[model samples]
Target: MRSFCLLAFVVALLLPTQSFAANRDQHIIVVSVDGLAAYLLNDPKAPLPTIRKLAKAGSVAEGGMKVSNPSVTWPNHSSVITGVRPEKHGVLANGVLVRGAIDVPTVVDPKRDQQDLIRVKTIIDAAHEVGLATAEINWPCMRGSKSLDDSFPDVPEQVIHMTPRLRQELVIDGILADETQPSFAANSVVGKDLIWTEAACHLIRQRKPNLLFVHLLNCDATHHLLGAQTPAGYTANAYADSCVAKMVAATKEAGIFDKTTFIILADHGFTSTPKAICPNVLLRQNELLTVTAGKMSDAKIHVFPEGGIGLVYCTNPATAAADREKFRDLMKDKEGVAEVIFPDRFTELGIPHPREYNQSPDAVLVAKDGYAVAGTPIGEEFVVANTESKTALGSHGFISSLDKMNAPLVLSGNGVRTGETLKSVENIDVAPTIAKLLGIEFPSADGKALNAALSK
Candidate 1:
């Protein structure tokens, strides 16, 4: 009997530890607040009290989430979901990148076209693979992204894209409705945020998807319209918090509150730009550019502005190498030009090279701290002052490393370590952390799981 007992003990010790496995029953809800600043989370006097509660309950990153290079909307949002950089995911900007030859943003292109460009696995894909139901409520790169639907197959029907173009049908105020006759007009900030929140709340109640991703961009729009501290911005923040409170109530009402984990974060921060610089006009002054009918009809190179950064695409491939060198030389010491990022510098920053894809730019022009890159056509001035007499001018899409550009990262519940503050974390780390919490895998993720923020 003693010999048998000894053998059983040895066999048990060799087996895999059950503690390493994730709590499959635990649910994860990610609420993306589009332009939340890191200082807002750190500030004890900021208007956001609910966010502070969640931060204290679990953990908050003291260093905030450093977003992808350029720190634009879609790219960083894509990174948060893919656990990879912009280069790996193939979404370098919010507007669709013309992968054919233009190598620039096509603002009018369909979201599905944008979706098809994503290359790697996302948390949604991993969740679906493990038989977990997932829903995307206004989250970027999920509507018709091949990475999500190709792996999941049932993703399209599960999304509620509240934007004016892809608005879904909903029953608001207990009445059937669509964007055409929205109970809340889809264009307004309230409409965009509230409609999405209502739709997401409905999904959580009815579908009960194990993973629900909700993006609220009201604060972003408000900040752009009235600046961060205006009454409208505060109103937007309050409504966003109320949305969270609603979801929390729903989880408890459904008896899933204790099993649910809530993660609230933002894509990038907002800052004011003193001027909008048009670099293409400078090329025209040098006679290197030609504009016919207010467009770059006969130009050797085209400049696409992205807030505080601009990408210059060489129109002539034969002279591409020479054009890059010439453009870099011409732009040196130019007003508002911070650093002319050449192709060689791209790889070091994890930007995809032009040789690998048609969408890659030859050189990216970074702006000075108080400047933004203007999408000015041929006739516009080289630099225009940012007039604050009209709409408030808060902006982003700058390099994420800037102190003011750091976005918030608040976490709570599930396996999160209570009252802990991590020193550093990037938006790329979010996907893998979600995957780890769900006991899933995203093999192509560039960021490691945030082990420091999790409880053993």
Candidate 2:
């Protein structure tokens, strides 16, 4: 009888993670709902049943989750997964700017690939190393990497974007194969979110991946159109909450309710802007930017616009310092510009101190209240009056110091403290916390695990 028991134990250790995950109490699911703000979530009318329930069961960061430098979606999301700043991870902004490259791709650009970007390993890498099945649902950094067993190609091509053509790509993924599904309709951001929820539930049941990373849109998408915390934004938030509940129900139906750990977080918060500043336009006025034959020339100084902040890259190695100082001088007290970050101020924001990437921006230009920075090189004016997008009147990537910039974080499951409120935790801490819970080693992560969230 003893020999038979020993043989069974040895066999169990050799099986795939799914089998072990069933017996062990270490499954973790990370759900990143874009544009989730503490201010909105706490509002009495906001639909936060899933978030509130999770908070009630585990630890909730009362003040909120602080995003990485610039507080943009891609940068902060990458920071959470890699536990490092933009400098180390190489995601300088949502839109990659290579000074001399022929292509500049947006999130949905067909040519976009994360191979040259994403310098470090993510939580998915660590989990995969431990012989676990890992999955990602529209998280950017891992798009191109082979880290996910189930995935959307990390390329911008697989964004499940709102465009009619982009939406076509989703139908091809078979998630929306049923033309009868609401997602098959035109302009359905909500439908896309629903499909992602379905995918999460599907993957959870089918593969039962040890670590599942999910990203839900509605809130960010809606807030970008309606403005932060507005009725429309609230509706989006509520929709996201329902999706979260759906995923949770999937875990329960899978019969692993007692073993799974769930985390709900956002990349950053959103705020309204009165005007938009085009630093490149200003640079052109100062002759620092050169346009020839109706096209932008490869000027020594280039500004990369990232909604609320602009990164100024100086290509001339010899005069990099001088140009950086000049860019600072040009933006100082400028109508819509606030802080011209370089040198000490740059590192002070917890950005990578000595950015090793050749294309790293020489400085950052922060927008003032009621303003944002646009990267348009051909703008007729340096400062354009604000308009609206289909999403929200508010924007993120603003000053991180403001309380409004705070996003929410809720943790629940085995080993997590129940009904506790944490004072603080940054986006960088997320990956490490997941690694700790999953028993994976990730030494490159800069953020510490939230020990306070774990039960003593």
Candidate 3:
């Protein structure tokens, strides 16, 4: 009998852990507050009562979450949802980088569908595959997704781009005057955020989706316009808190608060910059690119700006080697230039190789902390002052390794460990963690489920 008991215990240990078992009835709401730095939670003056309460009740990444390279919105958000970096997910920027002819300038087009942007299976797709209902509001790379039961995509002309049913419901509920472009465009940034919050609450009460994703943009915009740690930035953070409170209230009203889990996080953090570095201006001055009518007509090289990082593309393949060498010489002693990252470093940084991906840049130019990358070939000056009245005072999209790029992450409610503090986490880990909470399989994810943060 003792031997049999021991055998049974060993078998149980070999079996799957209960902490990772599927919970089909469980609901998870992922809220991405753009530009909400991890440090803000520890700030005494920051207004984040609701988020702090959630952290106190559940697990928190005290050291913050490391984001993907470039540290931009679309790439990091895709990492959070797909459990992979930009290289695997195929999202190098906020949109698809369309490569034209050898002499033609490439463009980042944001009108592409979700199917065209994301290469990997998302957590939402996994949940929907197993008969789980899902919804997303203002979530990036979710435009025209069939997996979502309801969606208001974060794209140009959002109201018109939203699912037909969602548009009709919003109109019927008096949240929108009509589905016209002009009507939706009339609302201010804050007003649009309120609409999104209301839509989220309505979905919680009505559809009760098994998984829901919400993204708030006010803090990010505020940071860009007024800079981080400013009074306006605090107000924007407070407003985001209010939005979360409303969603929490909706969950309680729907009688699912006890069974629901809330994962609040951000894509990347923000930093203030005193100067903007225009590498394209330098290229034009060197005659590497030609400007016509204040716009780049043709180029041997072009630099695509991603906030504090610039993607240097050799538009002319024939002169690629020479152009790169020339670019290095010109930028070697340039102020505000931090590092010139080549293809050799792509693998380590989770960036795609130029040979494998057409959108990949030949070289990456990272800016110093107090400078931002700008793509303006027509500008006479290579470096210009960043002012509130002209350019944005703050920006992100630095290399993810920078400490200032760390974002916040808090997991609360059902299936989560209580009063736990994690030293650090990765944005890629979020998807698998959410999948484990729902008891779903996400085998293709590059990141493992954060078991320590889950309750037994």
Best TM-score among the predictions, by candidate number? 3
TM-score of each: 0.85, 0.84, 0.94
In model 3, how many backbone clashes occur? 1
Each prediction's number of clashing residue pairs: 0, 13, 1
Q: 195-219, model 2: which lDDT tens digit per residue? A: 7788788777766777888888788
lDDT of each: 0.72, 0.74, 0.88
Q: Cα RMSDs of all predictions?
A: 5.8, 5.4, 5.3
Cα lDDT over the full model 3: 0.88
Return the lDDT, model 3, position 334.
Answer: 88
Off by over 4 Å in 1: 1-22, 99-110, 113-115, 145-169, 172-176, 179-186, 378-380, 388-392
Q: What is the lDDT of residue 106 in candidate 2?
A: 18
- By TM-score, the better pick of 1 and 3 is 3
Which whole-number lDDT from 0 to 100 does residue 17 have in model 2?
47
In candidate 1, position 379 carries an lDDT of: 46
Against the true structure, candidate 2 reaches a TM-score of 0.84
